[model samples]
Target: MSPRSASVNEELRRRSRERLLQATVELVGERGYEATTLADIADRAGAARGLVSYYFPGKRPLVQSAVHRLMHMTLSEALEREPVTTDGRERMARAIDAVLGLTRSHTTLMRMHMAGILQAEGFIQCPEQQRLAFLLEDTVTRYGSEQPEHDYRLLRALLMGAVVALLLPGAPMPLGSLRAELFQRYGLEWELGTPPQDEEPAPR
Candidate 1:
């Protein structure tokens, strides 16, 4: 057969990167941030050990990218869930729910990611994070923001604050209350997006 085309090469590279990121998530989520090492992540990804150094500067960046990938995928799926709506308010509500849901479902991974962001390393600013921001910004625009740039930042700040509060070590806040506060800020109803499954049904 003829040599593979440039497109094929690019696709292969993409798959390799994705595998590494996915492996990072699996390893870190199962073992916690401190316990998972780059070698372990590369092994789980079935990639060469040197490839870890080639793809990421170190464990923190790899883990950050992995978590961003997870968050982006979660929000994307929530936005496109069954019976999708065109209403901006509903979309914004769903976005909030999706993020909070991640905190509950992936507490260990998300907590580590939050700590990484707040630490001296600061934000990773990787492709995965940019994609997550783009999706959330789109949600803010859909929410009928008069100034998307400003409103998106505000929405992101609120969400981050909520996530931090929810994941704070030794003092985790109530998930339902956090979700309700975000929903109230946007005038969203309780039954929007992926609402808290653990919450008791509200009485009529």
Candidate 2:
């Protein structure tokens, strides 16, 4: 049999990496960060342990990238869902809600990822994160921003702060309050961006 072409090999590698990333997300979310290991991720992905090292320097980096991949996928699906609209306000609201939803659903995994980010490396500039950033930037631009660059930074900061607030230990803030503040910041209505059933979304 002929050897696989470079394109085929690259595609295989891409799929392999994606599987590992996905498995990491699942296991970490289910088992929390410290309980999940590279071995577990490799087994879940059905890939060899060596591949984990090849794809990531350590568990922290892999978790960060995996979470970013999840974020990108989550945001992308929300933006491209049925009844698509070109309205920037709607898109921005949807973006906020999508991220907020992820934080709520994957609180354990997201909290660990946040802890890792607060560690030495800060945030990894991985491809997944870049994709997430691109989508958010596009959302901000669509939201009638006269300064998309500035607006994107502000939106990202606000979203991060809200996520942190939601996941804070002991004194976690209400998701509705955080959501409301975000909606108000973008002048989004309570009904926008997968809004919850709460009457007040604003932070008290």
Candidate 3:
């Protein structure tokens, strides 16, 4: 093949791989990773299974690549966007709003993330899991003191807990209110707009 033709072929291959990866992300959200076979991904991408096998070789690697794509695409990068500052208070409010917005937007992917965690031991080990845990940790750690590592950890745990609560069969908890309460309990009071006004009674 001529050099120009080879370059065009390479570009097409790159696009094909990207489409396959995207297809995997969407399909995994619709049907959890376990239910999503290589054939399914191939069909969704409109490519043959041989092409998927050529690109990814196996199911686990494809899923791992998809997970990495998701981590970098949605969760990890959400915190790094340009800040709309109106002092620290507004920054904090914007941050919280951004976080909640990301959570809502990627609910399905988040569920697949949780499901992957639950079944992680089957085909995944500590290294991959720890990387993700630390990504979440880093995002939380951006908000406060160096000593607040534990607080960041707890906040992520609480966020995941809230997601699970909403996923349960029963009526969803007042998540917005519950999240606000959790934020207050963890020193997010001033960051999320002003606190409500109140008065105390005097003793007789």
Q: Write the per-residue lDDT of candidate 1 for residues 19-42, one digit (tens) a residue.
A: 999999888889999899888988
lDDT of 1 at 9: 79
Give lDDT for model 3: 0.60
- Whole-model alpha-carbon lDDT for candidate 2: 0.89
lDDT of each: 0.87, 0.89, 0.60
RMSD of each: 2.6, 2.0, 7.2
Mind sharing the TM-score for model 2? Answer: 0.94
Q: List the candidate 2 regions with Cα displacement exceeding 4 Å.
A: 1-4, 202-204
Give the alpha carbon lDDT tens digit for every residue of 125-204 in model 3.
33334555565555555555365568556765676576666554456554456556555655665335322233121222
> Which is the better candidate, 2 or 3, if ranked by lDDT?
2
By TM-score, the best candidate is 2
Position 45, candidate 3: lDDT: 90
Give the clashing pairs for model 3: none
Tell me the lDDT of model 3 at 74: 51
Stretches of model 3 off by over 4 angstroms after superposition? 1-19, 31-35, 46-68, 82-103, 120-135, 148-152, 190-204
Give the poorly placed runs of model 1, Cα more than 4 Å off: 1-4, 200-204
lDDT of 2 by residue, 37-125 (tens): 89999999999999999989999989999999999999999999988988888898889989988877899988998888888979898
